[model samples]
Target chain A: MNYQSTELQHQLAARFVVGSMRGLARRRFQRLMMDIPKLRDEVAFWEEHLHELTDTIPIQQPSERVWQRIQSRLGWVQSKTETTSKWPWFFGAFASLLLIVNLVMLIPADPVIAPSIERVAVIQSSEARTLWLIEQREQRLEVAAVGAIERLPNEDYQLWMLPVDGTPPISLGLLPQQGDVILDLGTRIDLAQVAALAVSREPLGGSPEPVPTGPVLYTTDLIRM
Target chain B: MTTPQTLERDLQQIALGDTAAFRRVYEATSAKLYSVSLTIVRRTDWAEEALQDTFIKVWHRAGDYTVAKGSVMSWLISMVRYRSIDLLRNRANQELSTDDFDEIPATDTLDSSLDSLADSKQLRVCMDELQPTTRQAIQLAFVYGLSHQEVSDHLREALGSVKSWIRRGLESLKRCLQR
Candidate 1:
């Protein structure tokens, strides 16, 4: 019960650094480590201690195709920007300025998209800032976020779709730290059975297991959109 | 041909935005990095994806590395590990199946061979001091990047107990290595 006990803290810190820390405890430990410089030191110590484990694995070369895929993905991201730039004439400076001005004016006068579904939810962090927007439209569910959140250099946040049926929550994807992200529910699960949207702090990318390793940071009812 | 040290110097130069150094750094580390990717991912396609991402990350985040952290190899390995883990975790979630969990190679064979080369006696000595359970827990978690739950399941031990073992094991190893 006494997590602060010297012996217990050392034990937990060591396990965490070596990667044996798991579940809610590991998540808590990670947050604690981030906040406490001493704890981070303990982690780095373990990392150095266990560095030799890497030697046990044979150095197998990844196939050339792996390199090709990375290049292509990077290329794709670059090309997307290029393609968007090509539309500048249609969405050129004057038109863009007008659209921005209109959006700014609409912010106060017009309500953001009203929920059409029976119930809609907006999940926000403890700081009361919007983190996710969940809405049901045309009997299909949708999740959206306005921007990627900035996170500590060493951490990541993951999105989850929880269902009211008490079944396991499905991972949506890694949350963007900046810029809006939209996910389509795509007639997969019954919209009525959906419960709430949840977010968990995870290793970069997301949790490896079906169950989340971190605590649920936010949860809110889905408003009808 | 550049030596590892020379390659590392070039990487440091690349970190300073020297394009020539970037090309050299890529040439030097790509094979080893690709090998690391293949071993963890087990899929050539995914490994390639990881390799590409790792380098791009290196290009962008090169300045983040500090010598105090460890060797260039260590820093780069950490990046690759994190990236590889991300890719593996994403793919695992998409598949919705646990059949293809990454496996750490058996240590006895790998260690014995490395012992023959014996480049770093300190590592071998430190490893020898660990209890089998502690050693196994650390190996599974660090080398394979298995979550604590996975390591517990793999070892068929209580999750709490596994955590303690790994933690204590790492502490003990650190003490030994530091000497």
Candidate 2:
């Protein structure tokens, strides 16, 4: 009802996120999120802010059979298992290509166009322990996990370049769990303008979309090396 | 404990029709989300069905997930809870009362959820500041999926008073959280 008003929008959004706005009112709010940008933002704001309520409720792990049934429902078990086990070699070959490319990029006489080694970042845990070591050589970014690392079985840690201008963080690529991997540093990255480097935990194949789908786990200022 | 980023990444993959990522998402979130469903639907079989439906919807709607709405876990939990609520309503319409439902067992583990975010931590501190009854009312409405009338019945308060308490409590919570 009359969601056009700012106060009403916030109230409706809040109620929707908190799960009190039920049945038809909830459906209307969902429609509003799609049609109205302001209303969408308001709902997003409430979802982000009030999410702690659900988050703090104790975590309950579902039974293992649930996963088996889900896998069966999706028909992913047999074929997907084979697919994942075969991909590590591709990553290895990709890592080798980066070395050759780095060598070739440095050989060109055109000093002006050739990218240079500019900066490095060492992402550490909250306890001040280094987690990943990053170096930017020419246009290629390399990341290596340094300290004791615990990898989420089904997830990948993704690297991001944060801009100082307040734009959303840009994905650099997935970080290697065991060894260094060459990253596809997109052309849009400006070494001079980049404010920081951050890593987020993402799914195994990495984020399908451009934006980060997860929280920034580790962040470190880009220090010119 | 599943990180929000991991869930987000999986959701993104699932959106693009990655079945592997969908499985991973289910593995990471199903238990916690199932617990939420179980708490509401009060039957493991029904909760399991709700959990399955939730992920099916998640696979189809992964692209719709956005950080502005909340962390990936919150989004997943919301889907599960809503599905559980729908199942609960369906059963309620069929049965007069399910008062003999078994009680939820206390959690023994101290697993950190997506709520470990600074935003949630701050919200928790603020929530601790709310009056016990106000907090309970909000919890009943929110976590239990109880409506105003149901909350009034549980809290033994008038409908108008329950609505006002929850409304004002939420307003204060929003102010406190923003601060």
Candidate 3:
């Protein structure tokens, strides 16, 4: 187990780099490399040697929504505070003031704010299981799942907005586990003479197949709002 | 217009809890990470989830990054690779049949600029020196993230043969690059 023999160590390092080395020997080698400067250098050498293999991959940009979601989840948009003073008290008082002002502003606003009913449709499977809900309002279409269905391991359900004109269904992105996921329907889709909403099971990430192999779990007619 | 050194410096700032640096890191590497994730997971949603999870992990563990481990970009790629591997491992359980190991259509071409990087250039030269079968075996293992059994099954070669090919191919690569 001498960590210093350049020849033997280099061979072990090469095997480790290619992922051919496994079991306790690989784990021990990784741990040993973490400590011995010479072993670390050898491992890095392999990493450098094999690094270009990654270049064979083409760069792809993910949807912009990814950034938005990351920002929202990380609370990155929240205001930053730097004052060392008893700022909690000051913020609490300021929040209370804003609340009072909002209450005052709402005193005679409206007794019954209309629940803005829009044309909507809920697509269900042959078993009458609701899979997705589509709503048209404010010149936009919103699509979401009906309930929290347990996601199958390595499978995803995608919502497609199909138009009556017999064109291909536009992907609205992956369905959420909960909450109403809103989508903007541009001029590309016609609201009138709209066909039924459909759901399809795709690979883990979603449909790479232009045509889905999984059955259409649900379809529902769109009712006018 | 930032140089790689400058990018690494910015990433170091991110490691120190700088939100601006975090945004910069996301801007710089999210797409590349997403491509790697999507290739492994083969689904958009799961790839998105992997991307989210990887970045979150990066945020929490940025402090753990050491210059000694590798370059900032390599370290980041390793994080994506590890997360994708975990996803792949879990997914592999459901679709583990030998029939599903057929050849996947090649979708994207390799970037030549990355080929010009000093380290990548060295790797390219060494990889080019290996036998075709051995090269494919190593690429399937590292790039496609296939297990040894998967490689053996896909190549229709014995499991021992696949192992030896990878070991020998990497050894040759190491020696060629060292020269």
Candidate 4:
């Protein structure tokens, strides 16, 4: 499906834009689009002509907040949290943060967190500042963003499982920024055989591929409870 | 109030990291993109997210644009439509809206910017060449983001027949439009 003749390419693109292609067929077409730029051009043609049908829908203005959010996400206009969370002086020392985390862990019990955890891992930058806290519960995992993560608005951080058997890493899921993200590691992963967890910066929905197509940003061993 | 050419230049400027050009592009297109978003997603919050994601993609990927992707408006609308459709599927609040466009042409109710939508207008002209049912099926799928099965069910035809009409309709439209 990578590159069909011009006529077939045009046909696939048309079915794609016309909304008749669905399920695996649709997903396959998209992969082909990614590999073949000329195919993308054909999609653009169908998109150009058929999308005009949307003209029937009357114009509806988005609220001003949409623009403001766009600007905020783009780091154009810093929101309140973004401005205050610059972490210039506070996050400069990783030792102090680890000391606090250790003291908190000794706080008689983490009842609120105990139920969902068999182990935990933290992804840290080269500067040793924590970016995501990874909690493993049975086959499920939770990722929480606590640091001032550095990334473009269009980029997403995906978590991966590196196997001790030296198999290719399995995608846990996209790392969360604002909300809670719990990824089911599924039955494919054996807990004892797990080597380390890694994170990578991927395009918006994480890497379109099973493996990391982007740079491997961080990796750390899982900690036993 | 800028022209399509102005928007194209704005995209070019945006690639160079000009914030003013970015805002100009957003201001010029957001309403139309929003309309397309709302139509497909059916929920305001989801539509807003779709709109937001589409713009973020545009701001990041404006450098990827070429004339081969069609007009700037087309490129932008394609992004909006694809994102909105994804949201619609993921959200699963799906139902085909009841509208048979056989007698009522899509172009008949265009907005004030019809002059600038030369591609759209030319498409409508070419769409006129399709069979009424074929034309109706294609319109429902593209305009409303209906799946092939959904289109088949909506048109009350067998799934196989609906798919053929859509494929045939698109082939005919492509040949006609390219002419």
Highest lDDT scorer? 4
Give the DockQ (2 decimals) of all models.
Answer: 0.28, 0.19, 0.19, 0.38
Alpha-carbon TM-score of each model against the true structure: 0.57, 0.55, 0.55, 0.64
TM-score of predicted structure 3? 0.55
User: Model 4's DockQ?
Assistant: 0.38
Local error of candidate 2 at B162, Å?
A: 0.7
Local distance difference test, per candidate? 0.58, 0.65, 0.62, 0.71
For residues B1-179, write the lDDT of model 2, one tens digit per residue: 56777888888888788888887877777777887777667678778777876775676568878777678876777777766775676445342233421242112111223235464377677776777667777776666667777667666679898888888898888788788
Q: What share of the true interface contacts does each candidate keep?
A: 0.41, 0.46, 0.43, 0.72
Cα lDDT tens digits for candidate 1, A1-225: 565566666677766654444434555665566556667666555555455456555666555544443333333222211211111111112222333344346435643321123334566778887655544444333344443345544556777778887989987655544322234445565656667778888875479798688877877766442
Candidate 4 local lDDT, B35-148, one digit each (tens):
888876666777787787777767767888998788999999988887787667655645554543232234323222333445547776786677777877776777777787
Ranking by DockQ: 4, 1, 3, 2
Model 4 accuracy (lDDT, Cα): 0.71
Which portions of model 3 show Cα errors greater than 4 Å? Answer: A1-39, A77-225, B94-99, B102-120
Clashing pairs in 2: A60-B31, A60-B32, A61-B31, A62-B31, A214-B5
State the lDDT at B53 in candidate 3.
66
**Residue A56 Cα positional deviation in candidate 2, in Å, after optimal superposition:** 4.6
Ranking by TM-score: 4, 1, 2, 3
Q: Write the per-residue lDDT of candidate 1 for residues B80-168, one digit (tens) a residue.
A: 66556655654553422245443444445434544543556677777768887777667677766677677777666898998788767
